[model samples]
Every structure is written in C-alpha cells, then in structure tokens.
Target: MKITFTLDTIDKAAEEILSQCQYKTLLFYGEMGAGKTTLIKSLTKALGITQTTGSPTFGIVNIYEGNGETIHHFDMYRLKKEEEAFDIGFEEYLTSPYWNFIEWPEKVSSLLPTNTTKINLKILDHTTRLCTIDNGSNELK
Candidate 1:
C-alpha cells in the first residue's frame, strides 16, 4: 500500500495504515525530519492512546499505554551496533504481544523479526510525504 498526504491530512493517512497494516512490529524508515514521529503520534491516537507521544531518540524506547494494550516505540538511530539492541532486551520486546513501532530500523535491521512490517516514508516537498507499506508476506488483519 502506498499513501501520499500532507500534514493536514495525517489523520486519514494514519487510518489507512491501521486498516492495511499486517503486523504489529512496524519498522519505520525515513530521513531525519521526515515526520516519522508525527505519523506515529497519529497511529497511537488511532489505537485509542490518549497520551502525548514523542520520539525515543535518547531513551531508545518509550512505552505507551492504550486501552487494553501497550505500544512500544523504538528509536534505533543512536545505536552503533546490533549488540546494543540486545543489551536493551530487544528480543524480549520483539516477542511481546504489544504493538512495536520502530524508527531508524536500519540501525538494527539484523534484529528485526521475520514478520516485521516495513513502512518507508519519503519527503515529497514541504508538508507532504509519501509512505509505502510492505508487509512482507504477512496476512493483513
């Protein structure tokens, strides 16, 4: 699935993601300032999470509480090696039942689960973005 939208229509983009995504372990790929965090905030809102969401650039990971579930947001940009991911119990989190949204996933590509859903976001001029979704053979929910 591919979607192009402006910041003004981010909500609709988020809804399209929720409807088409096939897995909970989502790997977000984008350059800095490409609105990865912005899209994530909308996704959390769509999932019924009321709290404010932010990038976990420094903390590595941020946990958010939804109605009856948990959302694990990860920022691997600061990681220098895959071992850094394991040091933070990355495998444990990958096996969890909660939703996992990862940014800069290329930093930990080797550690990504086989069923990971890859979302690539590209800036298409200011205020506009093109998001391409690849579920990797996983069945859509």
Candidate 2:
C-alpha cells in the first residue's frame, strides 16, 4: 500500500502501520538516510516502548522489553556479512514471537521468511517520507 503524509504526521502513519500490518515482522528497504530508523522509532513508541530506540547498525540488533511481546529493532546497514547475523541466532529471532523491525533487509533476503512484510521508504523531502509496504505478494516482484 502507498500513502502520502505530512512530515510531522510520521508518528500517526506509524501507528496506522502497526494497526493495519498483517505481519508482526517488518522489513525496511531503502537507501541511506531514507528514514528507516525514524519509521521504526515511531512504531516502537506506538507500541509503548519507552526506552530510547537507536539504530542497531553497529550492535546489529537492539532488543526492547515490553509487558507483552518484546521489540527487536535490527539494522543491517553496517552488516559486512550475513554470517554475523547467523552467528547471533538471527534465525531464532525471526521465528520468535517478538515483533521485529529490520533495516537494510536486502542484505539477508535469502534468510527472510516468504511472508515477511517489506516496507519501501523514499525521501520526498527533509521532512516528508513516502513509504509502501509489500505484503509478500508476487506483485512486489
């Protein structure tokens, strides 16, 4: 689905994404400075995650604990090899109940589930972002 929103309305759109998204795990695809981190931070706040959420580019994955299912914010922007993720049991996280938000998912397409929701982000301006989420449909190809 594709939609347009004002720059300041990112949080609102994020909430809508959380509510309407069929899959708990979302893969964010975009180039550098595409607002992937911003989208995910908004999603975490919508989920009531109070802790500071930053890019997991260096640490690989950042985990946030919640009363219900936890949130796994993963950034593969700095990933040099897929084996680094594999060594950290990334596969286990994929199958877990916690909601996962992955940035730079193109780096691990082979490991991602077929049902994984793919979000494509494009920077329309410094404040505006155009996003489209693919629901694992052949139409995406």
Candidate 3:
C-alpha cells in the first residue's frame, strides 16, 4: 500500500500501514530526515504503546512493552559491518514472536526474513512524505 501524508495526518497513515502489513517485522528504508523515526513513533502508538519512542541510533535497539506485546526497535545505521548484528544477538530477536521495527535495514539486508514488510519513505517537502509499503514482494502492492 502507498500513502502520502503530512505531520497532521501521520496517525492515519500509521493506521493504514498497520492494516496493510502482512508480517510482524517491518523494515523502514529512508534517507536522513525522511521521517522514519517519526512514523515509527506513530506506529508504536498505534500498537498501544503509550511511552515515547525514538530512534535507537546510539543504543542500537530499544525494547518497548504494551498491550501484552513486546516490540523490538533497531537502528542499524551505526553498525560498521553486518556481523555486528550477530554481536547484538539480532538473530535471536528476529526469531522471537514479537514485533520488530528495523531502521537502516539495508545494513543487514541479507539477514532479513523473506516474510518481512518493507516501508519506504520519501520526503516530498518540509512536512510531507510519500510512503510505499512492500510486503517483501519486490513489487509494491
């Protein structure tokens, strides 16, 4: 599914994304300042998370709990190599039955599961963005 949204409509965009996703793992792809983290914050809220959420850039990952579900958010932008993911037990997290939201997933592309969903965001202006979600199908649906 594809959506065009502004900060004012981000919540609705997040809900639409959740409804269209086919897997628990979501890989976010976007350039710097493209609103990846902003969208994630909206998504976490949609998933019933009441706490504030932010990019895990320095921490690598952040674990959030809400609505009887555990969410693992990862930021791979700082990794010098993909092997670094192993050092963090990323594989173990991937195998879990919880939700996973990964930023800079291209850094660990080979490790991603085939069933994962990919959300690509593009900045259209200062406050507008175009979001294209693909269900790991190569072609956007």
TM-score of each: 0.94, 0.92, 0.95
- In the range 69-106, model 2's lDDT, one tens digit per residue, is 59988998777877778977899999998798998887
What local lDDT does model 1 show for residue 119? 84
The per-residue C-alpha lDDT of model 2 at residue 33 equals 88
> TM-score winner among the candidates?
3
Q: What is model 1's C-alpha RMSD?
A: 2.9
Q: Candidate 3: worst 10 consecutive residues by lDDT?
A: 132-141
Ranking according to lDDT, highest score first: 3, 1, 2
What are the clashing pairs of model 1?
none
Off by over 4 Å in 3: 137-141
Q: Write the per-residue lDDT of candidate 3 for residues 1-141, one digit (tens) a residue.
A: 789999999999999999999999999999999999999999999999998788899999999998887899999999999999998899999999999999998899788888889999999999999999888752234
**C-alpha displacement of 66 in model 3, angstroms?**
1.0
Index of the highest-lDDT prediction: 3
Once fitted onto the true fold, the runs of candidate 1 whose alpha carbons sit more than 4 angstroms away are 137-141
Residue-level lDDT of model 1, residues 26-137, one tens digit each, is 9888899999999999999989899889989999999999688699999999998878998889899999989999998888877787797888899999989999999883
- Candidate 3 all-Cα RMSD: 1.6
The lDDT values for all models are 0.89, 0.82, 0.92
Per-candidate Cα RMSD to the true structure, in Å, reads 2.9, 1.7, 1.6
